[model samples]
Target chain A: MMRGKYVIAGIGHTAFGSLPGRSTISLNVEAVRNALADAGVEKDIVDAVLVKYPTSHFESIYGQKVAEALGLTPRINCVVDQAGASNIGMIGYAAMAIEHGQCEVALVSFADNPKTGSRAVFSRSRDPNAVFGWFGVPAGYAMVARRHMGEYGTTHAQLGAVAVACRRHGAQNLRAQLKKALTIEEYLEQPMMVAPFRRDDCCLVSDGGAAVVVMSRERARQLKVRAPVPILGFGQGHTAWDVAQRPDMTTTMAKASAATAFKMAGLLPKDIDVAQIYDCFTITALMTLEDYGFCKKGEGGHFVEGGGIEFGGRLPMNTAGGLLSETGMPGLQLVLEGVRQMRGEAVLQVPHARTSIVSNQGGVMHTHATLILGQP
Target chain B: MTDDEKAAALRPPADPLGDQFWQSLKEGRLTFQRCKHCGNAWLPVRSECPRCLEADWAWENASGAARLISWVVYHRAFHEAFADRVPYTVAVVELTEGPRMTSNIIGAGDPEALKIDQALRLVIEPDFGLFVPRFTPV
Candidate 1:
């Protein structure tokens, strides 16, 4: 619909929960097939495929494995390995490829089965150094929360508010993992994975897949389907890979990516209609809220306290429920949800949603990617 | 056991991804994966080049020297494993080779003393049975 910009023609997502019988290939194929059908585009039209997943711990070589399953083997493809930010980066790459004529149609898909006997925690084999030999992501993020509390006086109550806001949003999402409303007292009372981080503060690990079909601006028009949402801008940044090297555990690298995306889109934090920030943990959103320039630094704790992320807040975020409450399809689920919001087809649709920013943080306290999408 | 043996015990077991890296650390050398095609090196080695998609690369050793790019100090331990190491400092050291690495900052009395761009040298300590590379003020 828009000239000189790539757009998302269709999206497909698998049910976000545990499925024992479904293999990773089955999940991916289902999502890709449905996305192509929804876009009314045939599989032959897909010029490239960008598949993303954290496969270091998993044995499958993501790109080749998924390509073969899709029956599009040997097609131009690259496995993005930026961790949770993988899908968002793939989205940006697909858009740029479509814009540059390198690929006319690209399908980006991500899926992970983190709930099983799978090593959702740090890989003892991949990363042996440091203190996290046996620790998992919860412990890593808990360390971050502890540092935030020590420096900025962030409280567990404030932390619980993040879970509460996410739960409130999740209540509206049929696909969310935990939909029950949570109060501060109840949240604090939940079992502690680590001190200061309750079980509710951590995200649920489930199995699911998300797929998006991107095409050239011209192709979108030729299809004569629903008007597509355009990719306005995107950016990626990182502070350090490990938790120990992070400058301020509270100052997320999302700030760098957000600033770049805003400048590229010729917009600011004030112009966006909605946000789908990665909330692998409740504290992640708090740090992202401050880093994205939505609120001043250190005020993230307070900003989220009054249910600001709920409907009619300063900015409605994670409307489709986030990884915090939504299915743990990693953060790619958030991107799909962001596109749904921009299209005004969201279940918990924000009124008059025009522009949206989706962000995902990959790895431990490193690798941030942001994409700004809009309909203009 | 002697201090040398104790330090050696901290090193990780010989695995495909960490064998060479651990060996270099035992020699007080900081090693990383450098893509032959893209010339971009990365820590936490990958099977192939993230930029060029080339699997042809080698483990290039370094002088165990760098500058502190940035860092953070954690006064509270989030993970049960890091409980005793509260008030520890983590840093991003810019290697002489064009990449940065995430490692712990040791041999410092206070975490607040770390500075940006401070000269640092590698300190490979034995953690359990794995040899982990850390950085200390040079």
Candidate 2:
């Protein structure tokens, strides 16, 4: 089931921060049109529509709503949900649709007015088991960091390094919300959102949208733009929905998800030139690096400490400033950044980057997605 | 009430699925479901056992002993009910019977009070008319 069958033809996004006047529809319209324009494809040619699941209380029947807003009657349309990991899942589904002869061109879009929308937790209903005190995403990730610290002796300074690195990259990203520089000491001094996680360690709460166009490699070659990024590998992994039920809090389903993607692409971890691993919190990023085999278990601290995760280091991660500093649009931006890197268009490009991988998670590290992209 | 106010008013409501668990806590005992067929124990009790997927199960109280796995101190209040209770500590404690739960580590409002593998004893406290299980160092 190797898939050179699909390629990401184009990517587009809005200014990725708090824009008070924008609604999800308006944002989707802008991103969708930009993606279509970038792909050099007409709106009518995109016969399928796929979207990421929103944590927003303001939107519903997202795919159909977006399709109507754009005035396109796609042959197949739907919203995919893996929480924050839905971006890769949308791409995977789009590829499946093409392979099945369902659609020739697919438009994948994600938009959320998180900054303007009402705030709430990820869970729709509270589980009695979490009655004590669950502070949403921050708390969920803090427990993970605490466990890793207890088991592997990971330090707060090690977590601070992730925040510092993301901000360093964000400072160059014009579209990023928080473009200011940060040192490990400054990151350490930020207010603690939850224990083991400071305010700087968490991703920004922003309002924005991003979209990508996925089509067959054959169609991509026919376009006027340069060669599209090939969908070398894409896969999803879903584990326990509740944190208490997770087999191991330190490790996530990314192990299985990344293994599938790598096997499909016939590539190894060393082949990746850049990564856009999700950074909801500094700990999740560190754990994702470990879980995805970027480093040995319990060595993520050592792996990222020596200016290693920065642009010029061993593995340039979150080159789009990630969810941490760029925008909290979650999974979609990771894919957008991956495509940007492969196209040599990243603001903080990893030199000669031809192959890349992006990962995003949902729930309390419950669902995971790993996608690999390369030269057409 | 406004939307935020309504959202703030909502607390962790017990469902029928976990009714037995809530009741057991009210009785000053921490109980979990054990499958009669395969002898596997689990918490947040489901109708069927997870390991063997059998509906045949029995309720048993834990030894009230657990080991501290990890913990966090929240400096932000997520809900209006907890607005005044900012900067609280919540920990994951695994029972000696082999099930883990998210509860508070009392007297350890400070994250430094937590130690991995430290022995802790279970205590039940009433919150919003429901008795919830919490843990503290032994």
Q: Candidate 2 regions off by >4 Å? A: A58-60, A122-126, B1-11
Residue range B6-123, candidate 1, lDDT tens digits: 3454344557777767667767667888988889777666688866999988888877788876555654453445556666665557777755666778887765555556798877
Question: How high is the lDDT of residue A374 in model 2?
Answer: 93
TM-score of each: 0.75, 0.95
DockQ-based CAPRI category assigned to the predicted complex of candidate 2: medium
lDDT of 1 at A120: 38
lDDT by residue for model 2 (A112-166), tens: 8878775564423235534576657778788889889988989999998898888
Candidate 1 local lDDT, A1-376, one digit each (tens): 2222778888888887776777777888888987888778789888789988543245556777888788885346888878888888888888777666677889999776666537435423124544323234665676667667666778889998888877888888787777777777898787555455677877777877779898866788888747577888888887654764343556777899889888888888889898898888888888988898988988888888776887778788888778878876667788888888888888888899889999888776678899889973
Best by lDDT: 2
How much is the lDDT of residue A299 in candidate 1?
A: 85
